[model samples]
Target: MIKLKGIVAAVATVSALGSSAVFAQDVEKVIEARQSFMQLYSFNLGLVGEMAKGNTEYDPEIAASAAQNLLALAKMNNSQMWPEGSSKADAGLDEMTRALPEMWSTFPKVLEKQDALTSALENFATVAGKDLDSLRGGMKAVGDGCKGCHTDFRAKKEEG
Candidate 1:
């Protein structure tokens, strides 16, 4: 059976190759795309984390924007750039992302955590334009969802 990641990857490579134009080699462009996606993800996580932990005063506008931005980034098609013989094989997964192969190996857990995130996002959207306490529970759920996946999948990067 083709794993979901494999399926998504196949499509991404096909799309990227299909959309290609003859041009100079640009590794920078690929890196830039990855960086942009990570920026969107981390930015949203920072906002949500602050709101959840009450570390920073929560504003409805900011909360709503963060929630929506996270959802949008999560939905972006980024499968193709992560090919089998990519740098990870050339180098190593630990040297890059904390995401273990278990993310794909244990797909059900990943899906469950992802579903929790989706629920959190939806709940956040519902209460996003409301007062802080109104959305507090949803924010907690969202953080938990993120941490749950991170705990098992993401590697603890060495702090330099």
Candidate 2:
């Protein structure tokens, strides 16, 4: 009877370890997805930023296309990419993400910031194709929207 009990205990431990491994994989996937999404945001934003700075020629058609892509990306449903245990504070995820614990803890504040970004992007999309002057005028609000969220929720980058 004692041997049987020991075997059962070992099985349970193995099961627990398996579950933990699966959870870690899930967190990693979520972190990767969110990171990819941010990269998409940056890619689109860079196109417009370059034009605004005159680093790239401002083509109205390309500016409009990029701005529209940014708007679409901002509006994507990405809630699944932010599962509860995927933050930097989670075990094994510290190096996988720069998301602060407060992003989840502060709740509605994050939502508010998200709303601000969506609104700014919508405004940007409307005027982006109009002219260089209009694009320059709208860029500040879009930048501020991004900054507001990063300031409140993202961890400061570690200088390598």
Candidate 3:
């Protein structure tokens, strides 16, 4: 009976440790998702500015639809994007993610900066249908918002 009790206790300890590690990994995944989601959001929205400026010379229908899609994506909630261990502090950033660990260290400031990004998106929505000349200022604002978050929070893109 004593030996059986000892074995059970040992197994329980190992099981608990395993569960803890899994939880940590899950958290990390959430954080990574948040980073990637933001990148995707920015990359797609950038197309709107490019098309508006005639840089890509896209079809008007395609351009307008894509721009609207971008606007909708920008307003997404994305809470699920940040999992338990996803902070840059938990794991170092990857090649494409410029997020610095300090993003997690200073929480509210990052949130405020993120809110600025939303404002840029909303502003971009207003200018999406306009010509490049009309959109330039909004484009700059959106671009600056992206750079602002990335400069400290996100990692630079990895060159191929």
Candidate 4:
């Protein structure tokens, strides 16, 4: 009877540890997915920005392709990456994400920012391929739209 009880207790401990491991992996996946999505945004944005800065030759085809990709990404539904308990303040996941608890607390303000991004992206998609001057002119609204959200919803990065 004593040996049987010891085996049962050991199994229970292992089971509990397994559950914790699964939870940690799930949160890590969520963090990675969101980060990947943000990278896509940056990748497309960089193409236009480099051209705007005159570092890259202003090619209409490349600008249109990049702007179209940015528009698609802006319209992607990312609700799964932002599950309620996944904020930076969540236990055991604090270091995995920079999303703030206030992002949820602020409610429709977040939605407003998203809408602004969509609007700017739509404008960019329409004008990006027209000419260099058109892309330059459209860039300010897009930058402002991005800043409006980042300033409110994201935590500021600590400079080295």
Candidate number of the best TM-score: 2
lDDT of 2 by residue, 1-160 (tens): 9999999999999999999999988888878888899999899999999999999999999999999998998899898888887778878777879998888998878989999999999999999999999999999999999899999888889889
The residue ranges of model 3 lying beyond 4 angstroms of the native Cα positions read 1-13, 28-32, 58-63, 91-98, 157-160
Give the per-residue lDDT of model 1 (tens digit) for 1-160: 5698899999999877765432113333454566577677788878866776789888889888887877776666676543332232233334544446666666567667667777777777777558777767677776787777778756576799
* Tens-digit lDDT track of model 3 for 29-108: 66567767766766776677677567786444554555566667667877566543454445433432445667767776
Ranking by lDDT: 2, 4, 3, 1
User: What TM-score would you give candidate 3 relative to the actual structure?
Assistant: 0.70
lDDT scores of the candidates, listed in order: 0.65, 0.91, 0.66, 0.90
Q: What lDDT score is found at residue 3 in candidate 1?
A: 98
Best by lDDT: 2
Model 2 Cα shift for residue 42 (angstroms): 0.2
> What order do candidates take by TM-score, descending?
2, 4, 3, 1
Residue pairs clashing, model 2: none
List CA RMSD, all candidates.
Answer: 10.7, 1.7, 4.1, 3.3
Candidate 1 clashes between residue pairs 3 or more apart in a chain or in different chains: 98-154, 98-155
Error of 3 at 127 (Å): 1.3
Per-prediction backbone clash count: 2, 0, 12, 0
Error in Å for residue 118 of model 3: 1.4
* Model 1 ranges with Cα > 4 A deviation: 1-36, 51-56, 85-93
lDDT tens per residue, model 4, 13-119: 99999997997899899889998999998899999999998999999999999999988998999988887877878888766788888789887688899899899
Please identify which of the two predictions, 2 or 3, would achieve the higher lDDT against the true structure. 2
Worst 10 residues of 1 by lDDT: 83-92
